[model samples]
Target: MVASSTSSRSIAVLNTAPTQPSAVETFIGNLLELVIHSIEGVRGRLVGGSPQR
Candidate 1:
C-alpha cells in the first residue's frame, strides 16, 4: 500500500511505495509544514534553545 506523510521540510513516504501525493495534498502539506516549523522556531527562540525532554 502507498502511504504519505508530511515532515518539517517536505512530503515523505512512510514505506517503499512508489506512489506520490496529489497536488492539493502537496500544497496543503507544504503550508502546514511551514506553519509547524514557524511555531517550533518561535518557541525555540523564546525558550532559549533548550531541548525539551
Candidate 2:
C-alpha cells in the first residue's frame, strides 16, 4: 500500500508603512532574500547528490 500527505501554503502581506516606497522596498528585499536562500539550499542538495525532499 502507498500513502501520501497533503499540505497548504499562503503568502500574506501585512505591512502598514506610511510610505509606499519604503513598503515596496522592504517587500522586495525580503523576496530577494527568500529567493537567494532557496536557491542556495537547492544547490547544496544537488552538490551533495541528495534527493530533494
Once superposed on the true structure, which residue ranges of model 1 sit more than 4 Å away at CA?
Answer: 1-21, 50-53
How displaced is residue 46 in candidate 1, in Å? 0.6
Clashes of 1: 0
TM-score of each: 0.52, 0.56
Leading candidate by lDDT: 1
Instruction: For candidate 1, write residues 1-53 as lDDT tens digits.
Output: 24343362234342433354456578889999888888888898898995342
User: What C-alpha lDDT values do all the predictions have?
Assistant: 0.64, 0.61
Q: What are the per-model C-alpha RMSD values against the true structure?
A: 10.1, 11.3
Kindly give the stretch of ten consecutive residues in candidate 1 with the minimal lDDT sum: 8-17
Q: Residue 13's C-alpha lDDT in candidate 1? A: 45
- Model 1 residue 43 CA deviation in Å: 0.2
Question: Residue-pair clashes per candidate, as listed?
Answer: 0, 0
Global lDDT of model 2 = 0.61
Per-residue lDDT for 1-53 in model 2, tens only?
23332111111222433456567678989999888878888997879965344
List runs of model 2 lying over 4 Å from the truth. Answer: 1-18, 49-53
